[model samples]
Target: MTDTHTPRGLAETYFLCWRRRDFTDLAPHLADEVAFDGPLASVRGREDCLEGLVGLARATTHLEVERRLVDENDVMTWFSLGVGGSEPTPVVNWCHVEDGRIRAIRVAFDPRGILAAG
Candidate 1:
């Protein structure tokens, strides 16, 4: 595994942690004050972000990520999440980093699709 300081390395590490549902491992990659925006709600701060991830993991399975782009301090990842035996939902994740930790994340997915089935 590569060092977590680099953008691509951080993306790989983040994805690995996500796949394992290891929130603790993922925490180190997030800034103390992080901003997360997704289909469900917008959240700020590391605690809120972690809480949201935990809640999401409880409702999701078979989460897989596809790396789209990796630059100096930004990464674009595409993910497919299978929720409660439904079809795998597609999402685009954009992450911005500073000092090896994620400062911001924006996720785009079909909220209607998520809400329709839930």
Candidate 2:
């Protein structure tokens, strides 16, 4: 429920890509030096971020969005992540937008379930 011109909308687009398991459109939305911090790793720069995300996404079976909160250039999206057909793990991604691109993203989630499943 976001217009394509807004930050939330960009995130929604990313989520759509996640649902479809395609990230071909993701790189342009991220800043050249975007930062990504997650339970497993912290990566800087857009290439590394995209690489890490795609690498982890390979194990995903599904992504179900629960909610998204937007405050100016900041957006937080809550979703359920299904890995290897296992029970979904709740995940929250805090995204910071700058210059019409995603500058940073910090993800929060319990890795126990995902790690144990592997």
Candidate 3:
């Protein structure tokens, strides 16, 4: 696992954790007061975000990161999330990192694809 102390490294590690379904590795990357503004729901706190991520992992079959952009403490990742055997759903996440952990995450995507697949 890459160092989560830096923005780019943290972003990479976060995606890697998701791809591997390693929520234990994922948890430490989040700050205690972390907030997540997801495509389907918005939440605050690390534990709540972790719970939400668990649901996302169950719904997603795979995730492929297509692109990444990092500038200082801000990181943006563009990826495709696969649901079952259906086509991959496109997603973008903007992350804010501070003090070696994620403070907030804002995700953009259409849930119609996953919903339709279900």
Candidate 4:
């Protein structure tokens, strides 16, 4: 869906798209060139982002978004991740948006947290 909200609102929409695993909704919000940095990998371009997210969604289950904070061009979201029937691990995602699309994304989470819980 098209975003008519302020920068922060646009950021929220992006997260909502992720929650639903709706890449179509997410794709339009990304520029032709985008960048993603996460615990697992770093990717660039809208196509790569789409591919990575699809793979991520397939590998993750029971994902839940908890907290969201947006200011200026930055958006931070905290979430719980469940994979392979394991307990949820806390993850923090930080994103930067420009012209209504994501310019950069950085995700931080404890790898040991997942291993410990398992």
Candidate 5:
């Protein structure tokens, strides 16, 4: 499904595409000048964000959403990620929406939990 241009819609689309590792589906939900800030690095622009997300998808396995909260143009999602047979690591991502697409995203989590496993 395409992004619905709503805060909740954007969050759902993100997690859906992320779970499937479907960058194609995730692309349209990001604004042209989207920015992503994470524990590892920061990137700006849609292409750059997509590249980073794709690399992250490859490095990890079994991405799952554990909890989520949406308010207007902001969304917070709690996630679980794991590699191989290891335990899932907790991750929290905050997304800011603008013009029906995600304009910015900041993720917080224990880097050692998933980075080393990946």
Candidate 6:
């Protein structure tokens, strides 16, 4: 197992934790004041961020990561978020790391299909 202290390692670890729906493992990788921003939701703080991710995980059927680009404390990951039975949604998650913990996350994606389904 890769040590989750590095920015790249932490980002990769997050996917593994998300896949297993293991918030316990993921929580330690996030900063206490972590912030989350995405097209569907925006939240601040570790607990709220974890809660929002857990809620999203409920709809997640699969996560296929295609690539990861790392630059110092910033890691940008591109993946397909398979939600339920519908086609996967292509997503880009950019994470900023500080002191070996994820301090902020910004996600981008087209929400039209998801909104139409609602």
Which prediction has the highest lDDT against the true structure? 6
Model 4 has an lDDT value of 0.77
Off-target runs (Cα >4 Å) in candidate 1 are: none
> Mind giving the per-residue lDDT tens digits that candidate 2 earns over 42-78?
9999899888888778889878899999999999999
In candidate 2, which residue pairs clash? none
Question: Per-residue CA lDDT of candidate 4, range 36-112, in tens?
Answer: 99877999999998899877776677678888887788888898988656678898888888876788888998777
What lDDT, from 0 to 1, does candidate 1 have? 0.81
Q: Would you list the rank order by TM-score, best first?
A: 6, 2, 3, 5, 1, 4
RMSD (Å) of each candidate, 1 decimal: 1.6, 1.7, 1.3, 2.4, 1.7, 1.2
lDDT of 6 by residue, 15-105 (tens): 8878888778889889999999999999999999999888888888778999999999999999998676657789999999998899999
For model 5, how does the per-residue alpha-carbon lDDT over 1-118 read when each residue is reduced to its tens digit? 7446688778888877776777897788789999999888899999999998877777666788888998888999998877554578788999999887899999987878655554
Q: Give per-model TM-scores.
A: 0.88, 0.92, 0.92, 0.83, 0.89, 0.94
Positional deviation of 43 in candidate 6, in angstroms? 0.4
* Rank by lDDT (best first): 6, 3, 2, 5, 1, 4
lDDT by residue (tens digit), candidate 1, 2-118: 478777777777667666666787787899999999878899999999888778777786687755698779889888977766678898888899987999989998876567667
Residue pairs clashing in model 6 are none
Candidate 3 lDDT by residue in tens digits, 1-118: 8877689988888888777766898788899999999767999999999898877777678799999999899999999988766679899999999888999999998988777778
For model 1, state the Cα shift of residue 41 in Å. Answer: 1.3
TM-score, model 6 to reference: 0.94
Which segments of model 6 are wrong by more than 4 Å?
none
lDDT of 2: 0.86
lDDT of 3 at 34: 98
Better of 5 and 6 by TM-score: 6
